[model samples]
Target: MGIDGGIGRLPLAVADAVRTGGGEIRTGAPVRELRRTADGWTVVTDGEVLRADAVVVAAPAPAAARLLAADSPAASAELATVDYASMALITMAFRRDDVASLADGSGFLVPPVDGRTIKAATFSSRKWGWLRDAAPDLFVLRTSIGRFEDEEHLKRDDADLVGMSLADLGAATGLDARPVATRVSRWDGGLPQYPVGHLERVARIRAEVAKLPGLRVCGAVYDGVGIPACIGSARTAADELLTATLAAGAVGGERE
Candidate 1:
């Protein structure tokens, strides 16, 4: 199969497929605390407290820092250093007639050289199959803003963000349509930047966390930020947890 056919809208589509396979999703419940116990570990949530052989904290670096602060101060201290950028994505849907010179394909990535208020625009519908089928008469333009370099732009209001996106879109695709629907998503601390010596820092953090039995961490801040990388890290963390549990059991058996 061609690349696009094989990987098109894979994440969302796969999630939907899993739902068809009887997967359940939970919302509104947030974990409160995690404490290590003699037997294993305890997960404290708003409604319940549960026990598990191990834990893998997959939250962002700052949140992870707060979570690990009391128990794993060392790990928390290290995680606090992992920084993220604030960003906003504005998704605007426009009628084709209102937009001119826009192409139906992957979106354009803006290099810093563009020197524009908005970052990049993704032609969402054309790039993915499921989205394409939803609104045949409409075009979805996803524009990004705010980066480490452009920190000031993040303070802009919704009107400013929309204006910047529209300006860039107009310049790029000659699209001057007032969007039928506009959605803005603001990520407080966006994707983590793997700066120089990031690998070394992560290695040290992993080594420290390893010393804490029944404790593990897996997230975009740890291995990678991409979906595949996050999934891979979780899988690896699960395997590690299983190995540790088996080894502990063996020691207990010998003691008995």
Candidate 2:
């Protein structure tokens, strides 16, 4: 698939499309609760209460669990058991001339056994054509730190992390280059960890949620963690909700 500008641009485009389609988009408005009502469903957020025929709790497992605790206690409990991993990305940009020997490929992965702070590094300039064209004189690379239960490394200051990343990069690629610009992005509990019994747990959660009408849950907690997987899960949830709503309407019309 073609990446437009950067990975972040895709979400912005999606949001723009939704707006263009006359759909309301709210950012940073945390939903406080989901209440089932006689007419439909009530979504209580920090600012307002939105009434909808169906509600999809597309938050991370822990947040979703909190919202569903009152409606589907069983599902909430199961979702609460889902584990996650935290990681940080250190993006460094160096003057092309400062680096003696840049790697030929799109960076490399440092195995856990290698005893390095960075788990993986990506050569953003080489991997993405947009970035290369945007800054031809700069070499952009990003290094990831932290893994499951490996939170200690993230405590370091941004400068320290940058140093660590550069040291590791130098050792791996023999490029003792000084970065011209740096950025540190930390994602706490970003990636969900799918353990041995994760699928079973998800099945149980879904089954329990299915019992609650007008309520559905989807996100990194239930399906694959990648963007494509999350999108697929969302589509499935939306389709299920639409189908159920139509079936209920048909039954009500027949009774009328």
Judged by TM-score, which candidate is best? 2
Q: How well does candidate 1 match the true structure in TM-score terms?
A: 0.83
lDDT of each: 0.79, 0.86
Residue pairs of candidate 1 with colliding backbone atoms: none
Model 1 clashing-pair count: 0
Provide the clashing-pair count of each candidate structure: 0, 0
Q: Least lDDT summed over 10 consecutive residues: which range in candidate 2?
A: 247-256
Candidate 2's displacement at residue 73, Å, is 0.5
For model 2 the local lDDT of residue 9 reads: 84
RMSD (Cα, Å) for all candidates, in order, is 4.8, 3.4
lDDT of 2 by residue, 165-199 (tens): 98898888898878989999999999999999998
Q: What is the lDDT of residue 156 in candidate 1?
A: 84
